[model samples]
Target: MLVNIELENAEDFVFIKQLLEKIKGVKSVCVKEEEEFYEDGTPKWFIDKLADYADSLEEKDMISKKDFFKFIDEEICRLNSQK
Candidate 1:
């Protein structure tokens, strides 16, 4: 049999977990915090934070996509040549 308990407060959850641990046949108790995720499987909060960071970078000085790709390609070529 499986049991599910929901507690709004962290302290209450911890106390109940301890009490449940003493009971026989209660093999394992797992606790997980709920998180929202985007459709692409990325955490929504993290993606929002990344968007904010990118906006900040753009406000200062942003590199062109062409230049960025060129730099990456050159770096990859250089590294491959070293092998």
Candidate 2:
């Protein structure tokens, strides 16, 4: 079984985690900090920097989305061929 927990106070995380770990049937405890993301499950930082990335690509004469997709497709095919 797996469980996800959201704590009200960050300071209580360590104490709560230790308490849970002592339970007889508890196999393991993992901690993951919350992250902000878009509805599409994209990280907020990645989405925020996309425009900057696109602008840099455009400066290098790679302005078209079609060109980007084609490049990615070719790379995937090449990698698959190598395998």
Candidate 3:
């Protein structure tokens, strides 16, 4: 199967990478570099943090608010402006 995760930090990604090595039926568990989130914020490490939380909350196939908001807000604004 395919397990996608949003890690909270580089360290978390490292942990997942290592864990995957010892697991099975994982197919390919990867953490992709998400686009920047906060439009006018400190550019927090939100995506990494979200991924980290995912690793901790294994078996939960969902994105966390920590990083999802960034992309959502941007998309919303882009759509609204077009309308």
Candidate 4:
């Protein structure tokens, strides 16, 4: 038997997929949209800036994993504050 369901969000999709997979008769549960699993598009300027920033990173500038995540959190908060 084939069944199709539309979920409200990624959380629901994940929850439902796991639940469906537990059923004994089910063979597979797959997402129909490739965009959900793949990068659709990104702004060219943002991509270029990311590439440039990556290239600028040096061995000396490397930080611990904890500090790296802290920096990311700080940057996210800073960007959010701008809005």
Per-residue CA lDDT of model 2 for 1-83, tens digit only, reads: 78889988999989988999999899988877687998999988897799788767745574589988999999999999998
Clashing pairs in 2: none
**Clashing residue pair totals per candidate (backbone < 3 A):** 0, 0, 9, 0
lDDT, candidate 4, residue 54?
Answer: 94
Error of 4 at 28 (Å): 0.6
TM-score of each: 0.55, 0.43, 0.35, 0.38
Give candidate 3 misplaced runs (Cα > 4 Å).
36-83
lDDT per residue, candidate 1, 1-83, as tens digits? 99888787777987898999999989999986777887898998898999998877853486789989999999999999999
| Candidates' C-alpha lDDT | 0.87, 0.86, 0.73, 0.83
Model 1 has an lDDT value of: 0.87
Stretch of 10 with least lDDT, candidate 1: 54-63
- Which candidate's lDDT is highest? 1
Task: Please give the lDDT score at residue 4 for candidate 1.
Answer: 83
Give the range where candidate 2 is weakest over 10 consecutive residues by summed lDDT. Answer: 54-63
Error of 2 at 4 (Å): 0.5
Tens-digit per-residue lDDT, 1-83, candidate 3: 55567666777777778888778665665655676657776345876787788778754566778769988999999999999
Stretches of candidate 4 above 4 Å error? 34-83
Stretches off by above 4 angstroms in model 2 are 39-83
